[model samples]
Target: MNSLKTNYNIVIVLFVSIFSFQTNAQSAAVDQLHQLYIQTINTGDPGNLNTLYTDNVSIRNSDGSLLTGLNNVKKQYQATFDNGKYDITLKTIEEQDLNEDYMFVSGSFVFTKIDEPEAVQRGTFVNILKNIDGEWKIYKSYRYPEITNIKSIVDGLYKSFAQGDIPSVLEAMDEEIIWNEAEGNAYADGNPYIGPEAVLKGVFERVGAEHEYFKLDDIELHEMSNNQVLATLRYDAKVKETGKTYNAQVAHLWTIRDGKVSAFQQYVDTKKLNDAMSK
Candidate 1:
């Protein structure tokens, strides 16, 4: 009886020891992943970022745009660099473990205009990291603009428009769309268009008619309330009528309902668009 009791105690001790070691190992892995993410953003190196991301990582932009794969991530950073003037700083606020292999990290980012010290913008980012092959990599990333700025959503919308994926583009809107443009002095009155058909006819059709190719240069998305999103975007487009090129800035207000865009309103620099088309 005494020998059996001793053996049982030994087994219990071994089990506890194993459990503790595993918990510690997992914690260390999560810390390493957090560090890797911070380092990648600070270095602005795609390779470094890739080291902490899966090949098919999913990036969720503040404006609800989803970018998958390392190539897409690289392209996004390249676009920012090409624009010629931006700086980014990231801070991790919290982390939660979903499982042994999955964790979520939330943080804030401050973007500064390289040319204008006073012009600084801040946002939030949430990233999900997974452990694969004994390494922690970012499996997903989501960014949300601070309440005061909404450029990310605008960027995603314009990119969708340019890609001719109006359905994916419209999915980001609220139900009662509020459309406005800077150049045309045009306000799409009365909640604008709801559903895909109205979006296809009113916005996509009009823009597609004049521009042969449209590309978004930058986008920023800001979270205003639990359900409200604001976005600002800059785009370069080629006019089919005259083969002219124009860069325009646009803004949008979006309200989300039931995990779908319920309403959307857009504002664009019409003068810039018109001038490019005329030229």
Candidate 2:
């Protein structure tokens, strides 16, 4: 699963549409194409997408996965629907007609889970459509990253941590970053570690001192408002002295400012962690 472990941040970009919708002759066709996009996403039916695309349509996903051709794109959507139902809304910022035969639209989209309104991922999109014979078809679809790009940043830090490059990892944070550990956690000695040094000493150092074979896995990032990112993952660690191990679900709330992480808050299953720490 290519999950963002992605970050959330506020950002704005100029919409670039390739064709002029001003030529009212194309409005109905364009609107129909837009409606088709909405229907395809909401339905999560891969087969429905086949009608929207040319035989050799190109696609790029938010998670950076790529699929070329109509069939491949269909399978991607099918997998999405098989996993969960997505209710997606599309907002077109601009539209342009590249020529009499081609058009482009760039805009934003938000995908929300039908079951849980809170589960949402918002992103930008660029679509290129072709007029083949008589029907408008999607020739290219690209998903662009948001302004804050928290997912990429957090994923970088996770990689650094895995490599034991604490110094490099700390570079991604604000000098006066505020960090908090989960309540009842062994590393809560400095609940609000005010800076990198404090976080390193109070959390990283303590973990290294008391644990062996500690690892993080199955990490996924969800973007939230006010420049915050929510990451859900699992922590697997074996306490050194007690030889007790626990694999617990963990959540980290990260707030970014000027591209640097300004604050971090951890949420984990503390009871399980506490039990693992006990002698």
What would the TM-scores of all predictions be? 0.50, 0.50
Q: Which residues of candidate 1, in runs, are more than 4 Å off? A: 1-24, 85-87, 149-279
Residues 124-172 of candidate 1: C-alpha lDDT, one tens digit per residue: 8888888888787889888776654244555566677668777777666
CA displacement after TM-score superposition, residue 134 of candidate 1 (Å): 0.4
**What clash count does candidate 1 reach?**
21
RMSD of each: 12.3, 16.5
Candidate 2 Cα outliers beyond 4 Å, as residue runs:
1-22, 148-279
Worst lDDT window (10 residues) for model 1? 181-190
Candidate 1's displacement at residue 96, Å, is 2.9
Candidate 2 local lDDT, 4-32, one digit each (tens): 22222111111122223345556677678
Each prediction's whole-model lDDT (CA): 0.70, 0.82
